[model samples]
Structures are given as structure tokens and as C-alpha cells.
Target chain A: MDVILNFIAENLPMITILTLATFVGIEIIAKVPTVLHTPLMSGSNAISGVVVIGAILLIRDAKPDEYLTLIIGFLGIALAMINVVGGFAVTNRMLEMFKKKKK
Target chain B: MERHITDFLYLISIVVFIFGMKGLSSPATARKGNLTAAAGMGLAILIALFSPAEGSFDNHIWIIAGMVVGSAIGLVSAKRVAMTKMPEMVSLFNGLGGATAMLIGFIELKNYQPAVISTVKSLLSNGEAANLMNGEVFSSIFALIIGAVSFSGSLIAWGKLNGSLRDNIKLPAPQIVNLVTLTAIIALSVMIMNGEEMNFALLLILTVLGLFYGVAFVSPIGGGDMPVVISLLNSFTGVGAAVAGLIYGNNIMIIGGILVGASGTILTVLMCEAMNRSLISVIIGGLGSSGSSSGSDREEVVKEATPADLAIQLKYSERVVIVPGYGLAVAQAQHVCHELEQSLEAEGVDVKYAIHPVAGRMPGHMNVLLAESDVDYDKLMELEPANDAFNNTDVVLVIGANDVVNPAAKTDTGSPIYGMPILDVEQAKNVIVFKRSMSTGYAGIQNPLFFGERTKMLFGDAKASLGKLKEELNNA
Candidate 1:
């Protein structure tokens, strides 16, 4: 009801930012051709690893009695870590293969 | 003041991410771009962890344990994985992102459990708790559902890639079941949004159904469609993370997630065009699964050539194009393929690599393989330009590639790959293919280029054949 409406009104700025970001993303990606697609996919996947920030935010808010929350937070951090670390590592490895020849 | 600093860092990270993606668009700067984006993520994590306005970690052991274990998994797996196994690894990483977001939603729910229960019970009694059904609550639930689907769907994709899953989980009218499950999720979500009374059990049902929806969505897909499925699942992870970010008021999270979501979506659309198939037809799966267009109409006499013969023709040719596909990756033949190019180059023959969009297990897979072999970046030509080059080309050497060069894509409307954007190898002056057998490609579509008048089939393992061919050309 009014709560939902107020929530939307308060977050209108974030929503607008997200929409604009998506358009910008589409514009940038449209310029990348097929040969660069794999790197593009892996690189963007690495970027979304920003969710580790969300994991940290939730974990810090947890109290001692909220064990389930604590454990979920830890696991969430671990998964986000994997996405961030593995994604960047893999993308780098793939990108290294695309180096210009020295000669 | 501390919060302001942290918010400022998030803004900078967003900019870095955009610049990183821009750098990745070109081959020369891609590695630097990846490192830059990684630095951005690292800064964002540091700010969130230490900012005084944000909640601080009380248990050092738990947080440290998560970081150490997660970093070990990421570092070890990424280094040790072979280039051929890149697709499943990408799927695994994407799945983890989705799973992380899902768990965060669950953690948020744990914090709100008592209040949620009381509010729902109050709503059942027609009280004022309906106001509790706000955006955060909706976003948390959205994260829960979307994250579950992305996680489970990626696992299935991994299994399919590794061949653990025996077949597509085909039941009669899976489309109906998929439709029903989707409708149920929407109906339940709306009910919760409208503040209809519900329980944790109802939420549990929704979670299970969401997971089921993922399984159903991808279970029927196999073969050439795997790339599209992987890209779709990748976008699902991004969407899940974006919703979770909405709940947490994390601006960088939203920006990063949207970028990923939008890129994945665009990639899928581009792939559909490369295959000349609509998105709807792609979702139906079983595509190109007609079982390798093989053993059909062998009336034409297929010419054969040995490495010695190929050496003679390529050594004298003025222009040569080499098209490599999944077979090249499977046989680990890129090094030799590059050597062959260098040998041909020494003879003053213009040698270039023709790359088809879906040539390997993933999009742009051949580029990675060729580039790894230290082939010059300028030598790789994409399908359209490569096709145009074929008209003036003296010879096209195909290494373990079939689908991309099949002339049926252009001439035979009755073929499964009739409309696919194949490399115009048939238009070249001479064609020589290296393979282990007359086997059809992953699409099970037979390549007419194999049997065309000018084609010379040199049957052997791609690596062995390329090695022998390189040796022959070197000596000549």
C-alpha cells in the first residue's frame, strides 16, 4: 500500500540509475564483435562480483543470535569471492592469449 | 563523513568497470582492462569492509575462513583449467555469483523473520502490517527466486558440458509445465506484493518452484544451443544480483549487475543472428540435434590429399585462409596451426585465419585458441569479411572445422544449417580439410564442403595432420 509507494518514491533515483546503466551497457556491448564475446562475457561476470559488497554489508549487520544469518553471510561472501576472483582470473588468462605479436 | 567516502569509492568503481569493459572490446588492451576491473572490485570490497558507517565484522575467524577458502577455489581452478574447459568454468563462476546473492537474501530474511511472521499474522487478522510489503521485501524475494534459478540452471549447464547429464529431461508438454511454473511464481509474487497473508512455507514452495523453473528452462537444451543457454544463465545471475542490490541500497552492485545483464542479453541476440535463428526457435532446443548431417547422399566422389600434396599446393598459393573449429581445440592443435601459417608466410603466401562466431565450444573460442598459439592478432578475420576474402583467396585450409564452412548453409534451404552464416570456403580456389574421419560437426549437420569438387580430405587427428603438414611445408 502506502509503504510500497513510499519505498518506490525513495528509491526512484537508484532505479533510474540502473535503467541508465543498462542502456550504457547495451551501447558498449553492441560495439564488441563476435571474436571478443567470450572475454566480454567473462569480464562483465567479474564486474557483477561487486555482490561481495552486499555480502559484507549483510554480514556486518548480523547479531550473535542470528547464527543462520551469520552462516549465510559467510557462505555468501565465499560465493561472491569465487565469482570475483575466478571471473577476473579466467578473463585475464583468456585476454593474455590475445596479446599482439612482438615481431 | 566515512559513509560519504565509501559512496564516492563506489562511484569510481562504476566508472572503472565501464572503462574496463570498453578496453576489453579490442584484443590489444583486453588483459589490462581485466586487471583494471579487478582493481575496482578490490577497492569496493575494501571500502565496504572498513567503512565506519557500515556494519563491522565481529567474527574475524568466520570472515577470514570464507575469504581464504573462496580465494583458493578461484585461484587454483582458474590456473589449472585447460583452455578447452573454459565454458564450464565460466558457468561455474556465474553460478557462484547467483548462489551468493541467493544466500544474501536468505540472510536478510533471517534478520526479518520474527517481524515478518508477526506482520503476516497481523495481516491475516486484517491489521496494518500490509504496509510491511514494501520494495525491500519484494526485492529480497525477487533475489531469492532469481538467484535460485541461476544457481541451479548453471549446475545443469555444467553437467551437460561435462556429459554427466544423460539427456534433456524430456517429458510430454514441457512447455506447458514451464508455462505453469512461471505463472505460479508470478501469481505467488503478486499475492505477496498485495499483502495477502502467507507463511515461510509458501516462500519455501516458491523457492523450490523457482529452482524447478531453472531446471525446466535449460534441461531440454543441448548441442549447438549450449552457448545461448550459457549466456542466458549468465544474465540470470546478473538479474538476481541486481535485485539483491536494490534491497541493500548498494549502487555499485546495481550498476555492475545491470551491465552484466545487458551484455549477456546482447550477446545472446548476436549469437542468434550468427546462427540465423530466432530467439523463440532457439529456446525450443533440439536445434541442430538432427544428429550430425551424415551418411546422406554420398553420390559425389570425395577427393583425397596427403600432407605432401597439401604442402605443394599451399607453398605455391598467393592467398590462404585457415578455418579452425572445436576439433582444433579438442586436439590441442593451435600451436601447429600457427606454425603452418608461419611456414606458408615464409613462402610469400598470404595466410589468414577465418573465424566463425560459433566455431568452438563458446563464442570467440577460436580467437582465444589462435591467439594462445601466438598467432598475430591482425591475421584473424571474422566470418563476413573472411567470406568476402574467399572470393580472391587461393586456398582455404580447414582444421577440424565443419559447420562454419558447410556450403549447405547458403544453397540448400532444406538443410538444418541452411541459414547459418558459414564461412565461404567453397568459393575459394582450393579447399583442404584435416580431420579424424568423415564425422559431422556438433550440429550433426553434414558439411557439403567436404564432398565438393575442389575439397581434398586429409583424414587423421587434427594435431598429427597439422604437424605432418607443417613439417612437410618446412622442408619444401
Candidate 2:
């Protein structure tokens, strides 16, 4: 009984969040109408930017023995930063796609 | 208290991000997507700034400063850039991702220190000393290489989209060079893994090689194949992020990366389908500029009919269909198209806009473009529904669109885009095309729609011509 409780205590956060997020993602995919995909995708891409903050956090807290951890965290932050910036840029460009052409 | 605040901010940012993603799934809410995403980013920044960290402050400051500078550049580009250059903008954005990954990787590698340092006596006596390496160096180096490759590759894609790369018959040597670069990168990865000390010099060299490989990979690819390349590179960025996440064991990084990777891959496939080209054929650089109907040929063939004549034609017609394409997008003439519909309806003529599934560059691209100009949703018809209607239609108006209206797809068995679905504009009684010139679409194939006898070319810019039609119809 103690072992099971310990397992639940250890795994609860990840398990609960993952299950909920996955379920929500699936539900959104199914229930949401197609007309909203454009903004939703852009929003999702923007949300993905949190990975950068996570990276920054890890880099700051990284221990000496965790040199590799810092690097990985840094990398994640950098890539996420790129995604956030690029995704916004692309979205902006896509918006202008219907703008009038100059003669 | 501060830590709790930071975590709360982080959680809120994450929720905003998810909300923004959900908002992006449709055209109606696309504009809102930008604001939602910007808010999420703002939240992320807040979290980063306030959150407690164990590392150097100076680096974080630099990162923050970089974000400000990058955002300024992006804002300026957004305001000043033309619509035609949107694809190039996507390429540039992709380049940012590539470059950022590369920079982060390079920085981590530079700051990297081994877990243990041997004594000076051990180094001198044996003339060899090993420093214990860790996962940080590996992740950093990996990101750098991947990012460098993405940056260069995306730049080339931008160049192609902007017509700077120029259309030409080219060799496949660049692909071979890319293959060589890949092998070297892999070998270098293995070397690094074998407890090698920080080799900044080697990494610098690899970075240069990867940059050259990016240019080489995209240079030979024709404009017709760019959307596929863009999508492919998008997938690469996601994969790079996923790799970085694995290196860090961050739950959010892993989740976000997987989401990007999976969606990007699916989008790449969808984009390839829109081009009516196989993903493999695009990778191999399928004949981008093999066929040519010269500008002079267009000059010789095109005869502009006044809107009065078009109006008269419409008056006599039993049924009329309008095919909206990228030309309509370039002209921003959906409103005028709507006006044309009203005019036709007044004449007791049946009019409908036939939208091909792959009409514009992306899926439902025509619909979104039209929607922005406030075209009625009811008037817009998808390929299948519109195709069924075309058989009885008396006239088909082919706007600035090319590939979608091409009859070659339906009739030409030997064509590269033989099996792709296309608008059956050829079945209509009379086809009137409004175009600036007879340029092929991204597929690099000349549209047979232009050459058909029933097709009358009204040579001009899409918006101007549509505006002209509106004026002429009103006068009538």
C-alpha cells in the first residue's frame, strides 16, 4: 500500500498533466470547426515559445555536474525562441497575402 | 513567494499558448491568433525575467536584448513588406529559427566545462589529460549544427521565392554536396560523443560547411518546388527542437517539439499535394523550367475585351462561374469579384466562384483570401461541389490563377502533374482569363488553360482588371 502511494505521489503531476493535455488536444482537434485553424495554429506556435523560458530557467539552475543539462536547456531555449519569432513573422506574412499589389 | 509567482506566470503563459494554438485552426479567427500568440510570448518573457535562475545574468540579459532587437526588425518587416514576398518572409522566419539554434549551440559549447579537470602534473607527465564531458556539450553542438543547416537552407528558399535565385536548368550536384555534409556532420557527432574535449575550432568549420550546404541545397531547387522545401525545413526546425528537448528532459520542450514535428510533417505532405507533386519528386528537383511559353507569345495571343463586351457576353450566357486563384489574392479583388456576382445576378445570370482545393498556395488559401475581402461564404464553392456545377455553366472566368485551371492536368497523360485534381474550367462554354502575364505557378508548368480556344485572355493586373470590370458593369 505504501509502495503504490509512493508511486502515485511521484508520477501524479506528469501523469495528470499529460493525460489532460492530450485529451484536450484531441478534443480540440475533433470538436473545433475547421474555420478556426489559422489563428489556433498561430496561437499554438506562440504558446510553444514557453520552451524557451524553460530552457532559460534550466540554464540558470544548472549544476556543475549538469554541464550537459545547461547545454540542452540552452539549445531548447534557442530553438523555441526561433520558433516563436519565425512563427509570428510567417503569420504576419500570411496575413499580407491578400494585400493589394502595387503597380 | 517569487518562485510561486514565476511558476504561476509560467503556467498562465502555457495556457495562453494552448489557447492560441486552438485559435489558429480556422480562417475566421486567424487575426486573433497573432494577438493571442503575442500575449503568450509576453507571458513567457515575464516568466523568464522574473523566474529564479542558477546561471549567469549577463547571458540572460543578452537574450532579452536580442529579443527586443529581433522583434523590432520583425515589426518593421511586417509593415513594409509586400504581399508577394510573403513566402520569402516565411523563409526568413525559418532562417531565424536555424540561426538561433546555431547560436545557442555555439554559446553552450563555448561556456562548456568538463565535470573534472586532471592535475597539471598528470597532464605534463603523460602529455595527455582528459576532461570529463557531459550532455550539455552534446546538446549544444547538435543544436548548432542543425540550426546552422536550417538557417542557410531557409535563406536559399527565400531567395528562390523572391526570384533572386532565377529560374534555370541546373545540375543535382548541390544535393550530392548536401549528402556529403550530412555524412561529415554525423561522423563529427560520433567523434564528439567519444569523450572529446570542447572543439570550438572544428565546430566553427562545420558551421561554415553547413551554411554552404544550405545555399547549395536550395539553389538548384526551382521556384515551383519551394513550398515543399519550406514545409520540409519547417519540419526540420521542429525536429531540432525535439532533439534539444530530449537533451534537456524538459516536459514542455518535449511536448511542444513533438507537436511541431508532427504538424509540420503533416503540413509538408499537404503542401506537396497542393502542388500536385510528389514529396520525393520535389526533393529530386522535378523539371521546374522545362516548358516555356515566352512573354512574347503572350503578347501575341492576348486580346483585351472591354468590360462592356464581357458584360454583353454575360448577358447572353445561361450560366457563369468565376475561378478564383492567386491572381485574385495578388489583386485583393475579392470585393470586386463579389460586385461582379451582384452585377451578374442583376442580369438574371447564374454566377458562382469555383475554388479548387489547392487553388492558392496552401489549403483553403483562396477561401481565406476571399474572406478577408469580405466575399460571401455562400458564394464560394469548393472543387467537388463547383466541378459538378461547371458542366452546366456557360462561361468560366479564370482569374490570376494558373495551375489549378490548367487543362493539362486533366488531359495530358505525360505531364508531371498528370494525376492532380484540377478545376474543370475547360468544360465551360467560354473561358475568360484575367492575368498580368502567362507565368506558370510554383509547379513550373505552363497552364494549358491559356492556350484553349474558348479561353480569351484579358491581359492586365488582377486588381486593376477587376476594378475596370466593376466600373464597366456599373456603367452598363
Can you give the TM-score per candidate against the true fold? 0.90, 0.78
Scored by TM-score, the top model is: 1
The superposed Cα distance between candidate 1 and the true structure at residue B77, in angstroms, equals 1.3
RMSD (CA, Å), candidate 2 to true, equals 7.6
Q: What share of the true interface contacts does each candidate keep?
A: 0.76, 0.18
Write model 1 residue lDDT over B1-476, tens digit each, in one string.
76567779889988988888878776667788889889888887777777675334456566667878888889889999888888888988988988887777665653454234332112122134453365666787788888888888888888887768737466567678889999999887776555544466666777888888888888877667788888888887888878888877778888888888888888888888888887787786555544344446657667889998889888899999999988899899999888888888888999899999998878998888887889887898887899889989988888888877878778877677778888888888998888889877776677778888888899999999999988898887
lDDT, model 2: 0.61
- lDDT score for residue B12 of model 1: 94
Separate DockQ for every predicted complex = 0.62, 0.16
Model 1 misplaced regions, further than 4 Å: A1-7, A100-103, B53-57, B114-128, B163-171, B191-198, B289-301
Task: Write one digit per residue (lDDT tens) for candidate 1, span A9-98.
Answer: 667788798889889888887877677888888888877777777787776766666677778888988988988899999998887766
lDDT of 2 by residue, A1-103 (tens): 5433543454455445544655455444343332223323333443444446445644554555555555455555555555576567657555444232210
Q: What tens-digit string does per-residue lDDT give for candidate 2 at B91-187?
A: 6666666665565566555655564422311111112224423334555566677667777888877766665666542545766776897788777
